[model samples]
Target: MDITSQKSAEEASGRYCGILAHPTSFPSPYGIGDLGKGAFDFIDFLKKSGQSLWQLLPTGPTGFGNSPYQLFSAFAGQPLLISPDRLRESDLLKKDDFLDIPYFPRDSVDYGAVIKFKTKLLRKAFSNFQKMNNADLCAEYDVFCEKHSFWLEDYTLFMAAKEAHNGIEWLSWEDSLALLSPSGKAAWKAKLASETDYHAFVQFIFYKQWFELKEYANSNGIRIIGDIPIFAALDSADVWACRELFNLDSKGFPVSVAGVPPDYFSTTGQLWGNPLYDWDFHRNDCYSWWISRVRHQLELYDFVRIDHFRGFEAYWSIPFGSTTAENGHWVKGPGKELFLALEKELGRNLPIIAEDLGVITPEVDDLRDSFHFPGMKVLQFAFTDGRDNTLMPHYFKSNCVCYTGTHDNDTTLGWYGGLDTRTQDWVRRYMNTGGSLINWAFIRTALGSVAKYAIIPLQDVLSLGSESRMNTPGTRDGNWVWRYYQKDLSAELASHMKQLTELYGRHPETSVWHEQSGFATLNSRGPQS
Candidate 1:
């Protein structure tokens, strides 16, 4: 509410309970879920559950690995997520296109097979278009290309270059393609014109389908919360196309990468190989790049959660070749200057959530508080240490967003099942509840907390165990593939949750929760997709 000065008091009110499920995890016959019926049905499910928000992982085009955080382009949607069913409806594809459909795993996404099949399907769709060019759709495609030319042109060219070079990393491409020289760029543009236009057409399809689904969700009163990773992957177009904005060498290799120093997760620490930003260059441009990025996310989601929010105050910079984050040093970030620039570019009221987890300090807290962005609280991290138990519900403030567990952590039941006797006892003593019905117990405890927004992962809501857990940090393979059946969303489950939400005065439709007025009273406030 502090960020947006435009909305009325009535508009700024409501305590919300939401579910976290990435669109890729949606149940579908396709190898991966897409922006099609599955997404719409999930919206229907959200409305049925009385959930106001649908939280998702970043939907940007994935590269290197299938990790959503490591994206090819910050602005482009994943073409793999484009539904063949939706394409059929649009007449871009036919039943024959799916003649060789691989039997994908119903319980998990097979990213490899999905990619091959979807790529072939998309190319076939493009080929079919050559035979039948629908005038109206073509006109819309032209307008979309014109409007998004700034990002689309570079993205399409980048994708074509990737294809031409047999999908090698940008840095390894030929000098002309890597540096984008004047004559070289012109020659490639002419030669790869067809390939580039194909990529752009795919983006147009992604944009059209995604916005249509978003509109459906909005119409049903379900708001979306999207994520923004703090740093871009070194291999991403965001860094490659704008090499000057990152701390990169002449060959586009990062001088310093981004990661945290040693802590709870590992003694060596998690060394994320994303390129560190050139804050001085960004500052010189008045943070225009960041403003544009924020603007794009704001348009996509009702609320944007900035992952690794502490990075804005101070980031951990690791030497590019380091194997461990222990060798990293903390470097100062752009801080409030960046967000103030965002506020000016956007509006007074910015809908942002700060993923204020990990090694945090008072400076980070101050930065988050200054923006009035809600910091996150996870229940699984609460009982890990006695003195460090700031995550306990009793310590929670109403302005924060609380979760039973996040994607990085195990599901609630999974976490409980893995806990030792002492920790389990501590959890019991704290909640005044035994091991029985632990998942629902945590759900109830989260809803009943002072926090204004309580969001539980879909796995916790369904009482699933480790097998259903979405992602485990520090792993490369066998992650980001969990899927839920349509039948998993039972009426009984929805009723149970709605009862708890209403009982705790946490139903978003009723009133907004706030710290100053307390949960019983009323105030207003405001992540990641």
Candidate 2:
């Protein structure tokens, strides 16, 4: 798709609804989700459920305890997510090769064993590709490299160097290589050319499999939404290659890190250790790095959600060596200047959803509204104090998006069941219903809101509890490993979702509820005939 020809604000103002299910949540026999049959099946499920959007977490190669936000390379796809089944169909793998693997748990991903097993399989597939001598695939690989060489070459080299150094962080390498000197880079490239090409070939297959899945979804009226974190991991290829783009010290460590100050959620505040961007350097370059980042994402997604949107207006900067986020101070950010540059370069107002959940200042709201980007409202945050909280559905504007629960929150049922009596009573009173139907009630409220888009986490839609939660913000272990079995997505669930979506005018254009006078179209001009 040509992102430059995206719909204007007016054309995009439709009552689109979707589900938030990361690719990892898709069912697979590989012990983790991959770009395989499970992915295509999930897309079919979304189409049957009357959904048009399929929101996903960052698809980058994860690092540092397997968190997607802390990636090895901002531009590289997770090689572990490449589908063995797809490789087999393409004649690069065989079923007999996978027959000896140990049984994997169906309910959750075991990243450790899965990584070991998948890497071995990927190596075999790479060997097969080298020997098969298929001119067509080799030609396609060349085209892929040319199209993505801007980032791919560097990422492939970075991974090759990491392997050469036995997986040590880049900063710990020899001084010349750590600093990315010209002589050091050229020498390493010459010595490790084969390893670099192998990694690049892996990316070629990963992207090929991913685009095939994405094309299937789009053909079925399902749009894929991708995520972009506000900050990059300190130990990333992006920061290592472009040191001047971030606030790194002489030793290539963050001088001042990024985090949020104490908010209503916690007394100590959230300390996100991602490195801070050097806005001055970025502004001097007219945000060319940012433009490339957004451009890369637009190629893979129909819409992009900018996580930690508040940071763009004013970021919380913790002084070097701080133990907690409480010591951070709010620093001014690049703000509208960055957006204007993006608009000029992209030649279109990008479809961005602001994660305006934390301590949002008026400046942040103004920045988000200026571009007419939809801001997010999570329902789980609504009943904390009372039904009158800002996150409540009744207070949402038309240019906003609402969620029953986000990845960071416990599943809706778990949240409601664990709430205090006062909070639970307030929630019940607000909806005028018992708590037995809390998940459905929240889903209905979000869909019936004035917000233009309503998204429900797949866990919430399935009415799962804490066991299905995607992540816990401050924890490092036991995150991003949840999975669902194929049987979990039953015909009954699809039928239920279809009825609710049709009732609330969220179905595709042809299935709207015409008789319901209360059903207003998303745009001011009202429903189509």
Candidate 3:
């Protein structure tokens, strides 16, 4: 859709809802989820349940801790998310290759095992692609490489060198390579030419499968909402390729790191070790890096949610060696100057959502409103203070996106159960519920809000507890591993969701929900054969 049509639709269809699920959480037999049958099936489930949007975490390749926020490349799609089944369909693999599938737990991802297994499989596919010498396929790969050369060249080389260095962080490499000297880059490129090509081939398959899946969702009237973290990983190709744009020491260590002051998620505040951006340099350069980043994300999703919107106004900067955020202080950011540059380059009124959740100030609100980007209102934060809180439904403006709970929060059932008795009673009285189905109560409240869009975590729809939580801020391990089974998306469940959606006037195509005529029986293809 063009920018004009998108604005028109936003004005017309003011109420919509969707589910927040990362692709890795989808059920699959080959360990973690990929852009395979499971993804398509989930899309089918969304359509059946009357959801028009599919919100996902950042789809970039993950580094340590398996957190999507710490990405290997700001521009490249996750190679691990590529579908081996699709590769087989493309004659890149044989049926025998599937015979050796390893056992994977149904409820959580085993990232180490999955990475090892999938990497081998991807390598096999890449070798087959090279041996086949298909002219048309090779030509398509060339076009993809050339089209994305601006970022892809650096990313593939980064990965190839990482492999050569036994997956060590760039700073630990020889000084010349660690600093990304031109001579070092040229020498490594010559030595690892084949390895670089292999990485490029993997990316080609990843983008191909991803766009195909995205096309199917759009064809079925489900627009995807993707995520973009406010900062890039310190060990990422973005920082390594453009070191001068970040606050780095001469030895390539972060001079200061990104984090937040004490907030709801943590007592000590979350110490996110990403290298802080050099905003003065960015402003001097007209934020060319940010412009390309936003433009690339816009090409990937219908709307991109910028995590940590307040950071653009003022950011919390902690010393690089600090373990906690206690010593951090707020530093002024580029503010409107950055957004104005983005708008000038990518066109006015970009389709973006502001995650205005943490330590917000009036200046931040003004910056967000000036661009007309909708900030978020999470229902999980509503009842703690009272009805008058900005997070409460009654206080929400029509421009915001409401959520029962975000990925960082506990599932609604889990959160409600853990509340103090008095707070729980307050919630029960506020929602006029007996608390039997607190999850559904929160969902109903979010959908009924004045916010233009309402999003629910899939775990809440299933009424799962903290065991299915996606992430816990400030903690290092055992996050981003939640998964649900295929049977979880039953036809009965879809009908119920559709009924609630229509009741809230959020369903676009259906004005009435028929109990007698329930949703169609599920014929979704199960886990990979």
Candidate 4:
């Protein structure tokens, strides 16, 4: 189907609602949320809450700072998220494997502890797999390896190299390994074959478990939205395996890096420090690398949201060692040519959402609108100026996606609490509600918007404070670790969400009384036809 036809299909479905929460934030006893029962249960919660979508952060293995945006491999899954329970069921693990479960904090991920515990368990599982020589499972693993070998082989080898060098970055390794000396490469590959295979086996397990969980979500009317960062990490398998696709020096150092210019959030600007793409090279190959990247991500999600969508039109390039993004300048990107190639290869029915936020220029808007991709709007930004209606619900367009607040922002309750008396009073007047229910006030407005889709952070839905914020941009620590207890997804909360969704036409009017929804008929209030 063409883009117009695909968009019409989405519009015909009417407004849909979603919850923004990463899988790591799911409550679990085993240190972090894994692709296990908790994941399935979360899908069930989304269904109960009248949510049709579940948007999550990237699933890739995080690197140095433990940020998902800066991943080890864009194509590999997070091994730490592999479920031990699932492994045990497959006989790849036994109860004894977890006899010394580490003390992981319940409220937030102690990434250090979780990594140690999960790594030990995963290594043991790999050992058991080899000892048992489980032919059927081994065959499945081999098939998975062969299917993804194009990228998986390089990623596994990269991981093995990282381990061999005591977790040092690739470019900093010895001359032979760093420069890819032919003889040294052969010798090192032979030496690290076992370790590399171990990484490959872990990825096989990740996809196995994730496929199951994603199947469960789809079965229950929940679609997953996955994020894809615009830039590749300088220390990533992508930069290593596809060197020509990035602007890197001969020794693998980035020639220039990625970042955003100074804005309301920062004076020096936010320096992301990831390697910038060599758009000319990508275009020379008809964007094959980008097409493959998007294709791989599409397989993992129902809808793939391209982070920093504006970068396609132009990107901010900072000097390699710049301390801040203030010195960066905008450079023209692949723009229409790249996306046009993607559409030709992947078909125009691509289920994509552009995260068209930040200092958006008319060119960025043109690019996003040209492809019929849904741009995003956050309600929290609406009242920044009392007269700014662009962010207001009443001015929202049907082709967009609306949010009360995103993972980058504080929870609605926390944001309201931070505002001065004047701003707080303005918020109250705008929403036409008292200060007591600010969270729901923002949520209701989002659902009531003309935007075809509305998403609320799990924090806002639960009325959490700043302490539960998932991420705070520009900060290095105390982010992406928030976890919510199962107790927080109460029956009352689900019912309230269902009622609001029904009242605002975000959900099917008749579905409110469906026993599966766990809510009685809300006949008193329903959106007019």
Candidate 5:
């Protein structure tokens, strides 16, 4: 491992606990969570709760379905997350911009309204910036554009062209643009230079604000853990700009797509219509694209959790026109060769957490273990099977990260409430606790387990029910809209969480709060209620 990778590994090695909450869940008045006071307040809450980490969902710009995993560009920060207050602070916006702010719900994001409002403000900010004469800021923007031109130039042009074509899919555009012909690219660049620059300007502001927030979190001793999905959406800048890297045909239609086969969960299975990677081509190119992707993610986060990590060893590929994933077949993936190439360029001992869920094979396990990357264990999956279930806390290893539930799963209380009586009884018997306040029971169990890291979703901490769930798999609507209010982060709640965290030896360094709070000693049973 190089110095950077070694430092990251060291940071991730200790026993610690954190809340798993996305930035969008942070409370704000601008109809969405942003890198404003709400975000800084969240970091302060983490510190007061004795947390050293803050795990997040993918921060990329959401595309169709308003899902972060389905992004416009894997390398771009979500413009929606840009704080209007921060813009005003930078003199890019003024107080008049907030005069017509809409009334947004405190508990959920109305994405449609939020998008329209934020888009207008962002455009205004860009226009204000263009009319300004600030040499320092302009120079900084120029540096950012030049530094990221490898992906920025293509991304901006793609966005501009998509806008020009009334937001239709690239394949439906003129053949020259759809195919990304050299002549067509040059002509479009010249024709849409101003619009493309506007998009680039948006990125510059997004990154400037995002990095400031990241730095604040780090300075507060809280490391951010970001997510990176394994597959890119077919309607993404990635597939639109680099066609040869994907399983697309001459007419830019997918030859085969990505999906998993039928399981007990559903008879037809899940058909995720993402274009599969042309692994042979990637390998021949030394996995340059994958390397750049990983490098960019590392820059945006202290540690990255690669979603659907098992796909690295092998993935399920389905025919393009398949209605369901039942007809998909398992195909070999790039495996260690890709990671080896990444390590050669980025460094070894990469700070990666593998989402090793689903039907993982020995090959996948081998690939994950080869790099000593930690796999995840969701506690909610433990009691569903039997005592021998690997997800049980007793079966957990110190090298793994544990969670009560992920963004895809219901809140811990909701999951427990819906469980069959037999399983519910088993859960109570295993944890040796009454069924009341089951969310806290799960949180305590996770923290006390041998897993090196335990992450409890904020909903579980707040004892929220199904309505507060972040997402539900295999569903299209009513997802990724959950938000929390400022009042939800009560001081008493923080104190309770801190007590449990310290009791489990998950707090960083010596616990002055535990000592001052009259705890008998470390790991003592100190007020479990």
Candidate 6:
């Protein structure tokens, strides 16, 4: 697909297949995957596998223990994911500079080492840019910063200030500085002007490299799907810059935080702790902040997957003093009005997928269906309750998107192996196949579903077990660390995926499959309801 050829919501409505793998999972020599060869290679794999979309987690600069959902700036890219190789190609880095870094693990990210080493290298590159400036690059950097200054100015300042303060949270700073008074901000800007400019320089490099990679993917008939977290970190540039948008105290701390109540995933519930949006404040301005956020994301991706989509309908608000998510109340969100504002600003309904997985209410479904955005259905969630579960293939609707597993879940094989015998038996009978080749079986089932888009996590595609899982919810460490080796994207696996996609009529040329072949016929089915 040419970047211009990407289908608008009006252009194509059904049977488009995709894959779920964050760019961080791409194979790379760097401590983590980056916007480099690994990214381009993965795009090639997507094209070869007859896939049209590549869905990724949020690319934001992670905050508070490396969760993408909690980011330093909702608008900025993770600088650590910026490719040093690309920098070298641009003559901003020397080969020897990369060589002296401590050896990094090939299979997982070492966040601490990667952060320290990359920060130092980025500073060096900034210094080099200052010394030997190219007129064209300088012009480009000016244009980039000017174009993004709405958010970039604050983000760059926040990053520079955080570094100056030895990585303390912004709330720990002095009252005037922390609250971002006009004089205080101006004084700080003058004092840290060099560091601020360097941070802006890094962002310019990141965007340039990423846009090139995105161009490569589009030229090869692949659309990039980007993720957007609905909440922002309390210690973020966003909160620091726009305190009125959140439920914060006079001192600029969250009065109430965001989290989910007890659900299938946990007994204590998950205390995300990110500041909740003050929907009334957003409503007063016709959701201008959200409109800008969505517009910015649409600039970077063909499609955006809204994480925790149900939160837009009704969000769980946890008290600021709570240790766990146990004590929280469901608060109304700026539902239809927000989307109306988005549509009015963009002149069309946005292309989005709703992460409507847990504790879904009818209102959530109403909100999703009203906008014609697809809701996700996970196959792993299906087998736990037999074939009749809403997540099962037989229960999927063509407007939905199906996934074998997601970043937060265990790989299919690992999840299956851990199931009790009765549940395993239920799965075997549900698909009418033995558990001998469960991974492929699950893939086949997902592909053959009524869902318009079918996605499989890279771990499930490689049939890897728990250790390869990208994340385990509620855990601080050992998450977002998985990496794939080049060998994992073998010709054999691509061929198999292509065959399954074609067999299920999910190829780009077809819209739906009327013929059911391998999977069992369930209690009632035409198109799943």
C-alpha root-mean-square deviation, each candidate: 4.8, 4.3, 3.7, 3.5, 2.2, 4.6
Give lDDT tens digits, candidate 5, residues 325-408: 988889989899888898899888888999998888899989999988889999988876778988889888888999999998
What is each predicted model's overall lDDT from 0 to 1? Answer: 0.84, 0.85, 0.88, 0.85, 0.87, 0.84
TM-score of each candidate?
0.94, 0.95, 0.95, 0.94, 0.96, 0.94
lDDT of 3 by residue, 96-137 (tens): 888889998988899999999898899889889989969999
Error of 5 at 207 (Å): 0.7
Which residue pairs in candidate 4 have backbone atoms (N, alpha carbon, C) closer than 3 angstroms, thus clashing?
A: none
- Each candidate: how many clashes? 10, 0, 0, 0, 0, 1
| 3 or 5, greater by TM-score | 5
> Candidate 3 at 8: error in angstroms?
5.8
lDDT of 2 by residue, 205-265 (tens): 9999989998999899988889999899888889888899999899899989998888655
Q: What TM-score does candidate 3 reach?
A: 0.95
The numbered model that scores best in TM-score is 5
Instruction: Report the lDDT tens digits of candidate 1 across residue range 428-501.
Output: 77777767657777887888888878898999888789999887777787889899888887776776665556
Clashes of 5: 0
Error of 1 at 281 (Å): 0.4
Ten contiguous residues minimizing lDDT sum, candidate 2 = 520-529
Worst 10 residues of 3 by lDDT: 520-529
lDDT of 2 at 56: 93
Clashes by residue pair, model 1:
3-348, 3-349, 4-349, 14-512, 56-529, 57-529, 226-528, 226-529, 227-529, 305-527
Stretches of candidate 1 exceeding 4 Å from the true structure: 1-11, 511-529
- lDDT score for candidate 5 against the true structure: 0.87
